[model samples]
Target: MKIIRKSDPVNLRRTVDQGTVEQRKIVQSIIQDVKENGDQAVLSYTERFDGVKLVDYKVTSEEFEEAYDSLDGEYVQILKEAADNIRAFHEKQSTKSWFDTQSNGTILGQKITPIDAAGVYVPGGTAAYPSSVFMNIIPAQVAGVERIVMVTPPGKDGKVPAGVLLSAHILGVEDVYKVGGAQAVAALAYGTESIQAVDKITGPGNVFVALAKREVFGDVDIDMIAGPSEIAVLADDTAEAAEVAGDLLSQAEHDARSSSVLVTTSSSLAEQVQSEVEKQLADLPREEIARKSVEDYGMIILCETWDEAVDTINEIAPEHLEIITEDPFQELGKIKHAGAIFLGPYSSEPVGDYFAGPNHVLPTNGTARFSSPLNVDDFVKKSSVISYSAQAMKENADKIARFARLEGLEAHARAVEIRKERWKS
Candidate 1:
């Protein structure tokens, strides 16, 4: 990892070009094929990309039973416990429809309604994350979505991972399909004979999937265009070098493009953490990917003061931020932009990633500056409710008509004028 002074210029744009023209062309073609050819196109793309030929794409009851039988009893229990925690946290985020009535006989309110169906995409193959199954689905469930459809790629053997299947089954989500990548996204958005269209799509995937979500955004709502995972550790002399290095590497190992940065006021701590990261990387299973991440994107920034470190972190707006200082909470208010904040030494990034009840699907890139983590709000839509009584219309007709006439919407003025005339009579 490179060590630099705070004065050094850094380009923090995480929205770098993700693919070439050819890759986008292929993704667009896949989307078009899925839209036009439906289930057949989905099957053909599954064979070509995942190298798996499937007779049926949906997960059957027999397969669900097999998934349950394959996992150990203890691991299954853990998954259940995680689901409970996820459900409990999201239930607190559920909202209700409400209305306010005035003495003038006007009713003004907002109605919150869950989307009819939601499609969640989970990546398969070498990267099968059951945790993602919970993070993506539980929110929709909490919001009372009628249907939750899940899509994931099958392995070369044409089977979804037992863990992913088990997680879906545990959550009572039975509508899972063995398809992934841009094709799965297209299927969710446009729908096929086998898979019905969804109101929204949420989850993470590779470059093609991200681009696919971008393309189908207006047709269906998406959580966010997530970029590579990133972490920024703000520490001082009080922070432990080994723990900091371990936490940084946790995100770095996620992808080669992942960035792990350490912003510290103490130069000694910066050097120590850099050395610790090198020592720990040697033993990591994904050493090559993590090493490249550290070498290319990772940095130890030496800030002259704590405020400078906080400013640097806010500027980066990292996906995850860890504060390992004497008083972590003291820095909490200072951090204005971060997808998730992990405080103190014990609060590692993985805790939130796996079991801690909070949604792990977070905003990436610099989007933390504007966007938010996936939540129940992502699966629900709100409609404004307005009811005007005869008396109320008589009281406000002139104001409404004049405002409409100012905008040159004469039809709108006439609509209000007719109501006003009826009320006067």
Candidate 2:
């Protein structure tokens, strides 16, 4: 990792919006093919990209049963426990339809309605993430979404991983499809003969999947265009250098472009953390990926003071922020932008990633500055409720007409004028 002093200017915005023009073009072509050709395009792309040919794309009940049987008793039990934890946490975020009545016979409020159906894309290439299934599905369930579909690339044998299938089965999600990459995204956005279209799409995927989501955003609602995972640790002299290093590597191993940063007031602590990162990277299984990530995007930044460190963290707006100072809560009040905050050494980032109740799907690549973490709200739609009695319309119609006329919308003004004339009698 590189050591950067506070004097150097950090351009985090530029680093976050790193997408190739060629990638966008390719993703656009795939989306168009899916929109035009439907299931055939999905099948062809699945074969070409995933190196697998499938007779049927949907996972049958027998497949689910087989997957459940394949897994050990202990792992299945753990998944159930994790699902309960996720459901309980998201249930707190669930909202209800509320209304307010006024003395003048006006009723206004927000009506909360869950999207009819939602699709989640889980990557099946290098790793299998059963945890993602729990995180994505539980929130939608809590929001009262009736139909939840999942899409993932199948292996060369044309079979989804047993763990992935088992996770879906545990959640009672039957519509698991054996398609992935940009094609799966297209299928979710534009309905295929086999896989029905969904109102919204969510989950993490590769660059192709991310670009596909960006392309299909308007056709269907998406969570966010997530980038590479990142973590920033703000430490002081009291922090353990080894623990800080471990937390940085936790995100670094996610991808070659993942950013891991450490901003500290103590120069000695900064040096110690940097050394600890190097020492730990040698033993990691994903050493090559983590090493490249650390060498390129990782940094040990030396700040002159605690305030400077906090300012730098806000500018970065990292996906995950860990404060390992003597008084971590004191520093927490100063943090304004971060997807998830981990306080103290004991509160590691992984706890939120898997077992903890908070949704692991977080905004990445400086997006936390404006967006938010995935929660029950992401699965639901809100409609503004507005009702006015005859007297209330008569009282406010002239003002509404005047406001509409200011915008040169004559028809809008006339509509209000007509209602006002009717109520005046």
Candidate 3:
């Protein structure tokens, strides 16, 4: 890891991917094919991209039973507890329709309505993450969505991971399909014969999936175009070098492009943590991947003061920020950006990523400056309720008409005037 002062002119931003020309053309073609041919195109792409052939794409009750039987009883109970935690957290975020009547007889309010259906894509080509199933599906359920479907690429043996299926089973979701990549995204956006289209799509995938989400955004909503995972730690001398290094590598092991940064006031602490990261990297299971990440995107900054460290963190606007100062709670007010904030040394990033109730799907590539983590609000929409009464309209008609005419909207002005005329008659 390279250590530098905060004054160094190093660029802290990672370039977000927009897909190559060939990639974009391919994604467009896949979406068009899925839209036209439906299930046949889906099956064809599943065979081509996922390297598997399926007679029928949907998961059956027999498959669900197999998944349940395959997983250990202890692991299944743990998933149940995690699902409950996720459900509890998202339930608190649920919104309800509200209305208020005005003294002048005008009724105004907001209606909160969950979308009809949601499709969650679980990344499953290499590794299986039951945690993602919890993070993505629980929020939609809390928002009261009627139908939820899961889509993932099957293994070479033509089976979705037992853990992924078990997570769905625990959540009471039975609709799943053995599909992935751009084709899976296309099917969710535009209905396939077997898989119905959804109002929104959530979860992460490879480059093709990201590009497909971008292409189908207008037709269907997406959570965000996620980049590689990132974490920024702001700490002082009081934080342990080994523990800090462990936390940094936790995110680094995620991908080669994943960024792990350490911002500290003490130069000595910076040097210690830097050495500790190198020492710890030798033993990680994903050592090669994490080493590339640490060598490429990893950074250590020596800040002159606490204020400077906090400012540098805000500038990075990382997907995950860990505050390990002497008093993390006191320092929190200074933080303005970060998709999720972990405080104190014990609150490691994985706690939020797995067992913790908070959604792990967060904004990446400095997007925390304006965006937010996945939550219940992403699954539901709000509609304005305006019940303008005759009393309120009569009192404001002339002003409304004049304002509309000022914008040269004669028809808009005349519409309100016509209503008044009818009332007078």
Q: Which candidate has the highest lDDT of all? A: 3
Task: Give all candidates' CA lDDT scores.
Answer: 0.91, 0.90, 0.93
Tell me the TM-score of model 2: 0.96
Task: Tell how far residue 225 is off in model 1, in angstroms.
Answer: 0.8
Model 2 Cα displacement at 124 (Å)? 2.0
> If the candidates were sorted by their lDDT against the true structure, best first, what order would they fall in?
3, 1, 2
Q: What is the C-alpha RMSD of each candidate to the true structure, in Å?
A: 1.2, 1.5, 1.1
Steric clash pairs (candidate 3): none
Model 3 spans with C-alpha error above 4 angstroms: none
Model 3, 1-425: lDDT tens digits are 99989999989877679989999999999999999999999999999987888999999999999999998889999899888888888888877899999999999999999999999999986579889999999999999899998999999989999999999999899999999999999999998889999999999988899999999999999999999899999999999999999999999998898999999999888999999999999888999999999999999999887889999999999999999988999988989999999999889999999888999999999999999999999999999999999999999999999999999999999999989776856
lDDT value, residue 225 of candidate 1: 85
Candidate 1 segments exceeding 4 Å error: 16-18
lDDT of 1 by residue, 153-227 (tens): 898888888999999998899999999999999999999999999989999988999989988999999898878
List the lowest-lDDT window of 10 residues for candidate 3. Answer: 416-425
Q: What is the TM-score of each candidate against the true structure?
A: 0.97, 0.96, 0.98
